[model samples]
Target: MLKRIWTIFIRDLTVNMREFMTLYMIIIPLVLAVGINFLSPSINDTSVNLALIENENPEQAAYFDDFANVELFSDEQKVEDRVMSRDSVAGILPKDNGYYIMTQGNEPESVLEYAKLLNVLYEADVQLEDARSEIIEFGRTVPPLKKMLVNMLLLLISMLAGMLIAMNILEEKVDQTVSAINVTPTSRSAFILGKSLTGMAVALFSSIACLLITGFYNVNLGQAALVVFSSTILSLLIGFIQGLNSDDVMEAAGSVKLMFLPMAGSIAGYEFVTGNWQIFFYWSPFYWAYKANDMILSKSGTWPQLILFIGIILAICGAVYALLAPRIARKLQ
Candidate 1:
């Protein structure tokens, strides 16, 4: 059985390599991972340009300068104009005994930065010396860069496996290989397993390569692999369904792009959102994978939690397979 499966896997992989698009798809994850790493420094950086009314106190100007580019305007009106026009995130207007913070209700990060600045300004005696002493408390808070990087990796890995597996199966259907394979000793179960294993192999390899290239120093390799593996199952199931519906590669490709819409929901809901709004996205199986990967990358994911995620993914995969397998098998007949 192992030998038969291996033969099928090898043949499928070899055939895929001969196709330019398929080969490129296999390397997409690695290429993207490298690109994201090169851009990580900028992505993690939080620097804002600030405009301040030209005040007589060089002390106030110098204090704000430490955190951001402190631009001096001719007057309060110019400063207010800059803030209102969104030329800068916020402006500072020094007043008697205190400061007035001018901000637009826009970016959240800018608001947070403003609040921190407010704290520093409030505590300071409006003296440069005192402000300088207090400035040490303010430091750059790096966002969860690793979680984001891992999220992209998971997304690409799933996409790679999903699209390729669907394409592969669809290609076989188009070539009429399914009819021949069906008549042979290969059971439907074995045929499905072989295709799934092919996807898993490609996904696992691409994911590991992505992590290694992007500096897997702080990563839990075992857990990352498990997450990638589990996530690939969902993608493969999607691919299977797409392949079953598609008559050709172009149709499959077009349909796969639409698949990313729900994927975007999976990412946005899990990462950018909170509260009751998040529950709406739990229906997406990919979200469980995203959640698990996020927790695993944070190194806070327990075995029980990992198992729960894997179980949910497996249940979804099983349900999808049960629903689609018979319909797909009939197609070959």
Candidate 2:
């Protein structure tokens, strides 16, 4: 059975490599990761224009001005007018010796821009405090670029695993090859195992390629590989079911778009929402995957944590496969 499965897996993998869509999906993520890495310095160099109003302390004003892209304004009203007129601009005001961020705050991007400004000011203040004080401080946050890259990997792994499996199965289903395989000496378990293994191999290969191309080497290799592999299980199941259910590639492609919701939610919740709001994404498998990736990327991941995540992912996969496998096999037969 293992030998037969290997043969089938190799055949599917070879076919995947030759297929335009499959090859494209594998190449695009690596290209995007490289592009982002090349563009990131420029992106970081792009500064936020901030208006600091009513900051009478010349020492503090000079201190703030020394920070990047901050402009001091004498009149708060003029600052407000400038902010109202300009896009992606924010202002800061003195509040009880601290600072308050001022912005339109209507758009999400504006709110994020304001948050970035506050972070810069807060960091500047922290640097001054560190000079005066002896205490050390740490932040419980991941870098935004790393987080974005993890999310990108999540999308790539999940979509590619799901799409490859679905497309492969869909092709087999269309040609009635599944029924032929079922009737042959190959058991249903062997067939399913072969397909699943093929998808996993491709996903892991592509993920590692992307990681290397992006120069994201600040990660635990063994744990990172496991996390990457575990992350694709959900998508593998999704692809299997969707492929078995759909009549053709068009229907399968449309169905694949629906999985993007969870993928997007994982990134949004991780990057934007925090605290109690984060619990909303606890049920999302990609959420766990992203968190694990974040941990592994940041070099803070533990074996026990990875184990717990692995168990959780396996349970989800087990439940999904248990519920869907029989039906899929029956359909193929």
**What clash count goes with each model?**
0, 0
Candidate 1 backbone collisions, by pair: none
Cα displacement (Å) at residue 44, model 2: 10
lDDT of 2 by residue, 23-142 (tens): 776677777777766654332344566666655555555555555467767788887877786356677666786766778765347445655655565647656546553645364234
- For each candidate in turn, the TM-score is 0.71, 0.70
| Candidate 1 local distance difference test against the native | 0.76
Alpha-carbon shift of residue 136 in model 1 (angstroms): 11
lDDT of each: 0.76, 0.74
Question: Candidate 1 residues 55-113, lDDT tens each?
Answer: 65576677667757778899888887787873346776777876667777574675547
Candidate 2 deviant stretches above 4 angstroms: 42-143
Best by lDDT: 1
**Candidate 1 regions with alpha-carbon error over 4 angstroms:** 42-142
Clashes of 1: 0
